[model samples]
Target: MAATASRSASPNTPGQQLFQALRRDTVGGALLLLAAAVALIWANSPASAEYFAIRDIELGYEPWHLRLSIGQWAADGLLAVFFFLVGIELKAEFTRGDLRRLRTAVVPIAAAAGGVLVPALICAAFLLTRPELLRGWAIPTATDIAFAVAVLAIVGSHLPKALRLFLLTLAAVDDLLAITIIAIFYTETIAVLPLAAALGVVIVYGLIASRFRRFFVDRAWAAWVVLLPLGLAAWALMHASGVHATIAGVLLGFTIPAVVGRASNRTTDADLGPSSQGGDGSGIDLAEALEHRIRPLSAGFAVPVFAFFAAGVDIGGSHGLAAAFTHPLTYGIMAALIVGKPVGILASTWLATRFTAGLDPSLRWADLTGVGLLAGIGFTVSLLVAELSFTAGSVEHDVAKVAVLSASLLSAAIAAFILTLRNAHHRRESQE
Candidate 1:
């Protein structure tokens, strides 16, 4: 019985198990799915209006001398945390990941630039003709990393490891573009006093953190308690100052120490292979201490919370889907993420590698092209962009949500299909 059980054991493979766990657990992804399910059920239910009325419920606080609004406040306020984590990720990627140096960074950086610029152009070309939709230009410029990663992860053995990494790089680049546009173009008016106050607070935080060796000293924990409130104050200041509150996240994220993992053990050989006879220092240094402190917390809490709040959308199914795909704003977004991303990324990376970086001949153009298509799968940050594309409570805002959902899901599916087919073809050719 033991032998039979061992032979026929249906235990999930590690990757498969990880995939299932991630799918079930991602705070926003799970909630988005649940919310989507509820939306579908409600839309079909007799109480459809009741389901949508939830979108209108007053969740604001207007007590004492302060009279604050709710809907946009909740959406924007909650999403600021999302941007905060994004700020951390963008910095971490550039400081330590593939973008660490020129030699290792060519294909991904070029591809990312193409992915971002092409989508913006496509959105602009279509929407610029229509003044009403012009405000939503940033919608198409963003990509959702989870949906893209989820697509690749689901395809499993079909995708090459290199291709997966390529997609990740492109997604990172896509994020940078979306964040930049949000900070630079989408903001209202700059309120100076609050901006200055926010700057002052950031400086103070930096000083306190540096003086205390917050990254290394265990005693610094108590002082670190001040971070959230300070961050909140900064965000409020930014909000008051006319700059998008999201930029405050970027500013704060830079002050974070970049290293969390040891460079030596980052590889598989270090973890599973033999330990060295000699040691390299205490192994628990300041950089690792900082990363050890920040990464898990950021990954587990900050990121998922952001995803849940930012990703929720009311897809009306057939009608909703139709409106999302057909509307000018929707069409522009669809075209950019689907059509322009792959093409632009491929062209840019090829040009950079061939004429500039001079990559290895073995890294064929087809390989890069396949990877480029995979990068167009932008999900998380794109949804946030959709929220900003229109003023709160407007019909355009609702339409923008539908468009983000439709375009993200569609592009993710299409990119996966294309890449899987390409990978299959490449494997067959190699086998021959």
Candidate 2:
């Protein structure tokens, strides 16, 4: 969705756009959790063999290295759709939202860096002796934006705008870092010709998107008919190139024009409400339109399906559970998520605000502490990264998944507790 400028004269605020987006994400996040739970239960049940069989089913063309298991499809293909939404959101924020201003954006960006760095270091520390498990150091560095925001929507509705915006900005930057890590660190091998082909297709796609922006924006089905093939071709080429295919989604998302086609002055439908922006050729922008059309598929289907396929780690009965707990991978990820994340966020925020004089007096350190805890809820992205870090069906892979799930749950609980107390304090202060 298009984020309104913070300085806009319109009644619609950036907060409103974020709230609306988070509302949709909340529903998706709940569904994601439910799907994960089901997968976990099914994998551990009597019919666990069937679950593994379905996940291991391969159904792609053998040529071009496209033949992959069901789980691989969910991770490498469907998850790209989810990342596309992230790319759109990132572009929108930079182009139109609070992030448009460097002054407004620096705190969260710095905090996000700290959040990433500390967890990675903490994970490294725990896995120092176990070099094999160290690949998962990036697992806890991400924040599940949907799940964290959904928790805030439920528990921190009465809290100040500063806290909500802080969380949003931090999570957005966190996603960018995760994408960077996946693109840079995790890539194993590169096939030069296919990579070049993918880049060429993406460039052509960008030209087509920019040229036909108005046409595609006007005709909702045009993207599916024309753009989908181009996108699929790009994705296929990228997959062949041995880069994580999901990066293609981010690249494609960056190409979409943030504004509508040739609209000299665009007013969001959000700004004027339904009656004003619709019906006439001046309603929503192309970026917003794409978000609305694609988010349902991304959040509702892509994410949950990926979770269902990915989260079915067989933690190997009681013996496996005990071994996992003793494993460095498990301890590293848990420590990173539960401890390292908050410490990093808080320290970074403190340093930024201290040196820059940008702190809002009304917002206490406690408020940020709660937000930091929420940042620890690194579920969906963590699972994807874990799969990337270790071979599928390996012991390290299973332990890492279990660690991510456990750490996410623990982080969510801690965040809820902290924010609830903060919410009560804020309510009491307002009353007084």
Candidate 3:
């Protein structure tokens, strides 16, 4: 029994750190909300023209052909870094978290599928004849993970803990789908020269990581240093590659050295060497390492920064209530996010579980329904997609932004309502 027992003494340390990082103050969730609120307030002020001008103004400089222009550059380029971090998140979830097992992933994946399909179909039905708007179908399928979680935090204890997790996982899967779609659908044309160069840097970086791992290098930081900048370089190259610049994030994320840490044990050989590459005092737990390395950067810094830029739509502008509400693209987008999202998610998840594959037994439809409504709040990715879905200054783009912001706020309200109601039910059941 003594031999069978093992101890890490602090296995939960990483999870605890991540939990703290994601809270109202730590992840900048509160600040993000404040910034967003202030931005809207300022944008609506008489100095609102200055707000738009600032967002449009180019800042920064680039030497050695490395462009560092701000405004859209900060907006689009830095966001590529944000997406790269998201890719890391998606990879980690599949490798270790709720997505690690088919049984666990089933409910959320199905729900996410339903959420995405319904909104897209809603958009199609509303705008199919105007092929111009068809491209933006993907805009409504995402839920802003940070903002949604922040919303829950503000609403106090009325929401169930289980529902919060369920909503988060569902949104994670939704993010995964959105990443795939961005990679597959939005690519423009192959500009071979820059792409070829980006490929070289990535391959070289991977080889370096593999070599270091094979040789048992303990400094995981080295791997990330190479991986992140190389990813940025890839984004720069891909900008000219006819690919949507964001896809670079996904590609780079897949390649990151998600290699886990080896467990320590007194019995293991002190220096097992390259022949037993996974040996430390124990063996590799690749999932743990990936979570440790990437989660901090993504959840703490990258995601928050990304939100600051993407969520800063000029709502305080000359958008008269009619201009905002009457736009077909606006209303269509609203319905797609608010109405179509939950309904579609419910329907598809139902279909998947009943006829094809079933949801995880741990989850219930009512639980999923609450999550589905939250999934309707598509703030982050919706805004990102709007940038791609429309050219600058077009009516399509303006209306889409207003629609996304409006729908997301409404969805948040609806989800909160449902969650509170569900909590009441849970209390009743427990009492019974």
Candidate 4:
């Protein structure tokens, strides 16, 4: 599932080619939506039993607790690849991108926090009476970057670049918040020995990645051969430690240095090889290089596969669509996503601007509003949280999935409508 670079690439440089391929956020989002659509259709069809059977079939080494259903493998195993990419992006942002400066980073960081906190409060409010159902309060707190960016690319061609950058930074921080919630709130128990072993493996993995940066950079195969096994070992240990296995990806990502080497005034193009230069002409660090190589896998295959398995809830069950829609949990999730996300983000951004340096001058309140609405399109991490919150095959699980799917679609549609109009206005202003 390696994606070809959509933008022009240096013919000689594979690293740049991979980075260009990763720029195709639209394609990734479409594939993810298509997979979910197929899952829903298949699950509701007459052959639905076959779909569940295939998803339920178990395999793997038993003694290590590795034996899991196909659906479980998609969630616990393959989705780690997605989280690994998230980890790399977070490191890049904090070390080099918008989050590098405290003043520049404050608004998006605060907005991300507001985005998470409000939706969670909304969920908690709805589930106050039904304390048993409160475990799912985190489901609507995530923003699916792929989906939100895809919508922006489609409807915001004329919008300011600042808007998109703001969305990207906000979503990155949103993902960090979601990762923290998962690691702390979702873990029911922890095995101290396995947890400690996993951390030790992560430390060792980081040391090697840092110590031998140039060696791995020179030979792309070296990372696959050396680091892949260590990553898997850490993931396995994390899984055994009763924490979600995906946290291992974040731990490993933090170990990779975001900047490769110090910039020097004397350095020239002639002195650097193709692998050393990024698309923007900065030094290509290990984290960026690895992210480029792995993003295609994460976006094209790993996430879509996870969506296929996770999104296959039978709407034609004995309880039917009405019951699922009317479920108190469903209402909580939908409201949190469709309403709480935008309000929280807008309010937080307003406060940040009022108290701090303020937003980019080119961006208007309308643009921020659209991006805020776009953040409501929470899919991948939302589904993952829903799974973690409820037992599979239980009524609560199915209802939560229904709520997430419906809310995401509604959010994307509403955001698209608003942003498309905004795009037209911007075009008219440009012509004027």
Candidate 5:
């Protein structure tokens, strides 16, 4: 992933550098999977009690109600870092990347909305008989960008760039939708004072970020030394606001400048790989630089660590693994992800292109089909939502985790098989 991203941002073309950066950061998906696997194994092993104990260990500033378990910290704290990176990607895409063009952006935007809405409705349909289970409707609505892109990088390397870009755009918008859902639906209570303080901090952070964009662009450590503290304050305040702290990451990320200032001069960093070619030194803007630096932190550490904390579901716990499979929520979540996601994305994209003026000439329905399958790989955020939906040690939560893991694995497998065939077809066509 690093090798792919670093190769060259110099090619002054608009989205090339952004795409490369995305590819590079997505490599961390392998590591994230490894962490989840380790957590699962460790939780189910003889050391299961130890694993649970470690995760439940609590420490934090208690007066502010900030004290939380290791697992809670991973969800509330580390995940913010991941969301921060998402914010950066979102801003860049909308302001400067392929999403800057209405025609280019409409298909993915519609597809993402459909992808989210259909899954929620599917889950609702299955759980309609049980009002208690309806809280988890959003569980399958998210697409784990890291896991999906990682699969694409491995299996669809030969596929067209447009397909890849479409996936990225859809996932980014899907995240925004998910964040909105979290803020609106999941938050049980709101503390206006803290929320207002968090917003104030965000505004200040944005202003400082805009004024010193060139400073942070030129010196990477400045972000760590200066921006990190403000980001933390914002996150802490947001947590106190009774809103999910991760939202703070997104707000902070949006504040960072996405494009280079006309007066600034900065070359693409050497870390962008040796293939870094085609830029007028100005193309290596602040957003790209932050992405280059923070992507590793989010993918390599923040996300994987969150996965480690969140994915430690004991299959043999009170509900038992067999019972989990039989649970209605399990079936609903699995159906929503494995079936609903692809169907939603494909149908929405097809309908939009047919009815509207948004279809890209270079894209085909077959390509969109493969992309839709990949969208089904919803692992990380799904698990987070599952956790939010039910109590920590309850049967429903445990069953939901099992469902998320099974569905994500199933989706990845199906996507791999479909994309493998599509890749071969594309290769053959190219040779002709």
Candidate 6:
């Protein structure tokens, strides 16, 4: 009976199986860290020249301004895959998950807002004297969900499930805000024709996915054959539009329907994953299906590759290290990420609990604090913003990268310490 139940509980499809493995926070986080480490080591090694040579090698059609460096391809192309997964998750939360209800969603939403605003304000304050450096204010505002989840998985085993839910919802909202900032502030210019074409393609893509969700869901290869090309077209057009191609990924993700048919008796809990459990009745769930299929590719390959290309910053020497640390821009980002993120998140969460809903009964203030500090480990999107904020290879750019790296490390260590202690306390309480 046990073996039969175990087999019955397994993921139903190959895509679902792969998604289960890749979605493990540790797997994705380890790959990202490994890639970033390789890039950092290579950039500072004897073969540093070769590293930059490969990264700078460019190829693409010149007519559409698609030609770009290897690094640029990782940033502008592969990262779109990552953002696409993010979009699916965001839509799921809004449509069926915690964010669906005002009562359940207020805390994370308010906390995310505080997280973004406080960090930006703190960073901006530090860069006030140097107005030129203010463009990078958003650099410290992002929360790397993969990294935070990985850390939590390691140290938060005894923590309440509510804490994990809070973190995931908070990060989702944080990603949405980061996307908005990129679409608005980072886009310096736009080509109206390409932008319009991109939107049109996105609409068509949405229509196909919604209208023919069963078609794609029934045949696993259908999405790859049909929607993949359309998604790429939208991404390409959006790229040409100069609106940041990753935005195309999010827009495309938003179009997929979260719930397909009305609640039916046949749909099992396992079919819809954890989020769509009680309420949805499990119609096709195209959004969840597509997310599972593509997430492995995004988390396993695309994000790590982007990290490798983006994290290869060269510090000249001991002198350069000192200079980067002392530079106003670097320290400013460090302060904002390490200090502001926690203060803002904690303050906002407290205020929300006071007025709206209280913290989960199983949770304590310390757990929230640890999650806030963990959020300070901003890597993926932070690096992207750092890239966009300053010229490549410029002093400000390198300094900003260094600051993000340093601050993230410090934040992770501190959060780990606090959470480890909390985990112990919880374990002891359970035993008692």
* Candidate 2 residue-wise lDDT, 1-432, digit = tens: 233432342436665564345337568888889989999999988999999999999989988789999999999999889888777877777777767878778888889999999999999999899887788889999998878888887788679987887888898778779978988899878999999999999999888987776677657688889999999999999999988898899888877767533233433334322221334444335676677668767766888899999899898799988999998888999999999999999999888888863966568888889889999999889999999999888989899999999999999999999999999999999899
Candidate 5, residue 227: lDDT = 91
Model 2 residue 46 distance off true place after TM-score fit, in angstroms: 0.5
Per the 3 Å backbone cut-off, how many clashing residue pairs does candidate 2 have? 0
| Residue lDDT tens for model 6, 22-67 | 8788889888989999999899999999999999999999998899
List the candidate 2 regions with Cα displacement exceeding 4 Å.
1-23, 260-284, 360-362, 430-432
In order, the Cα lDDT scores of the candidates are 0.59, 0.83, 0.65, 0.85, 0.83, 0.87
Which candidate number maximizes lDDT?
6
Task: Report lDDT (Cα) of residue 231, candidate 2.
Answer: 94
lDDT for residue 48 in candidate 1, whole number 0-100: 64
Tell me the spans in candidate 6 whose CA falls farther than 4 Å from its real position. 1-20, 260-282
What global local distance difference test value does model 4 have? 0.85
How many times do residue backbones clash in model 1?
Answer: 9
Q: Any residue pairs clashing in model 4, and if so which?
A: none
Q: Which residue pairs collide, candidate 3?
A: 114-345, 115-345, 188-242, 189-242, 260-285, 260-286, 262-283, 263-282, 263-283, 353-358
Q: What is residue 182's positional error in candidate 6, in angstroms?
A: 1.4
Candidate 1 regions off by >4 Å? Answer: 1-74, 156-165, 210-224, 260-325, 359-367, 422-432
Looking at candidate 1, what is the lDDT of residue 191?
69
- Candidate 2 vs candidate 4, TM-score winner: 4
lDDT of candidate 1 over 1-432, digit per residue (tens): 434433333334674334324333243344444544455456446676764465455554444212333334544565565555555555666666656777667767777887788878888898887898888777777655544555566553544566666666677567767777887887767767878998887777556544544323333354357666777777777777767766776677666545434333221111111111113322222333333334334434444544444444455567866666677877787777778877888878878877667654445566565555555555556666776777654666766766666566666566666667766876776789
> What's each prediction's TM-score?
0.74, 0.88, 0.78, 0.90, 0.90, 0.92
Weakest ten-residue segment in model 3 by summed lDDT: 267-276
lDDT of 4 by residue, 212-317 (tens): 7766665678899999999999999999999899889878888887784434222112112234444443454778668766777888789999999999998876
User: At residue 354, what lDDT does model 3 achieve?
Assistant: 77
Q: Over the full model, what C-alpha lDDT does candidate 5 score relative to the true structure?
A: 0.83
Better of 2 and 6 by TM-score: 6
